[model samples]
Target: MSTAPLPDLVKTVIVPARPDRAFAVFVEEVGAWWPLAGFSVGGASSSVAFERDPDGRATHLVETLADRGTAVWGAVTRWDPPHALAFTWHPGERADAATRVEVTFTPDGDATAVVLTHSGWEARADGEGARTRYDTGWELVLKPFAEHAGSSR
Candidate 1:
């Protein structure tokens, strides 16, 4: 008998803007809408940012809290504009144990369909719980994303 593959956790939303615009809001202005307090490494109030290295060698998605300083949530794996973005997500864990999160933007007339998939949980010990946690967490991220990205139009 063959074991089935692990299921990916997914969240999809439709933003009231073009794909490029939705992409910009997600990448360029993540700090504006990302809920930094309850959803970050610090577990307190903080700011989230997608900071690209000036030397073009690295990009970090980090959480910055007043007392906790900065925490690395992930590193950028793909940066395809207005289409797809993928990253390694290892918040509060070793880099070697990181999972992958991929978000894609599809254009639908003036609106944009945003689909986010977080996979590779088989690497973690608490993969099942993590997946459940992210199911709600990702929804939190998407609500603000849709609102913020929509208003930018």
Candidate 2:
């Protein structure tokens, strides 16, 4: 396999909600919309959630397996409500091999434009392969998030 550095994978989705509401739903209600069955480190029956600190700040993203075990996907790197959220991403791998995912919510008229940028691929042993999988994976993961966020009041 070639050792070329992969470009950042950027995906954008327009959600029918204000930036504040959109960001809230994305971070707080992620477990409801995230497609755990296909995207989880654990099996199909797993559930994902953001673990918040005592002050209600998100500190880490975790997936709970069917057998009651847990896998820490990543730690929160940036958390600005209604605007941006960023974290390290290494679902089944070591934290040292984690990539970075930064998502921004921009107000667009009556809706919000949510942009996700996945970078830092070179940290992983299979950076190119992982980037390829996540390119398509983010599409599937975001579809449900858009739908669920749109329907939320």
Candidate 3:
């Protein structure tokens, strides 16, 4: 049997929005904060949609120079409003493998602390590459989200 390493990444951010509002924006306004340039299923991701229901799907749609791509990242495994959102995460070639992602929003006085954990990756040939991509991706995406929340405050 082939053996490969599993992928994992984590990121955190503090946003000015309250916990409830921050959580809402994360699920509802994903298109505004997701950095979909190099990490998209295709070229440019047109939208990132999250369905809140248990087992609901999270999809990313993209359009390239000559082709379009759509990918189902995973289903919602846990959904606790204003506190936690957990789901499976897999991208492109790693689709068959499963991973878990948890985003927690904690009340920090008036602001919110957003902590993200990406783990449970099944070791595969490209697992390390996926980990690397997510490392940079989370930073990129969270930066904008934090800024957006801060500006609106």
The C-alpha lDDT values of all candidates are 0.85, 0.93, 0.70
Give a tens-digit lDDT track for model 2, residues 57-89. Answer: 999999999999999999999989879999999
Give candidate 1 misplaced runs (Cα > 4 Å).
Answer: 1-5, 55-58
What lDDT is reached at residue 16 by model 2? 95
Local lDDT at 60 for model 1: 79
lDDT of candidate 3 over 55-85, digit per residue (tens): 5433332223223445676767777887998
Worst 10 residues of 3 by lDDT: 57-66
TM-score of 3: 0.78
Using all chains and alpha carbons, the TM-scores for the candidates as numbered come to 0.90, 0.95, 0.78
Clashing pairs in 3: none
Model 2 pairs whose backbones collide:
none
Off by over 4 Å in 3: 1-8, 52-69
Could you tally the backbone clashes for each prediction? 0, 0, 0
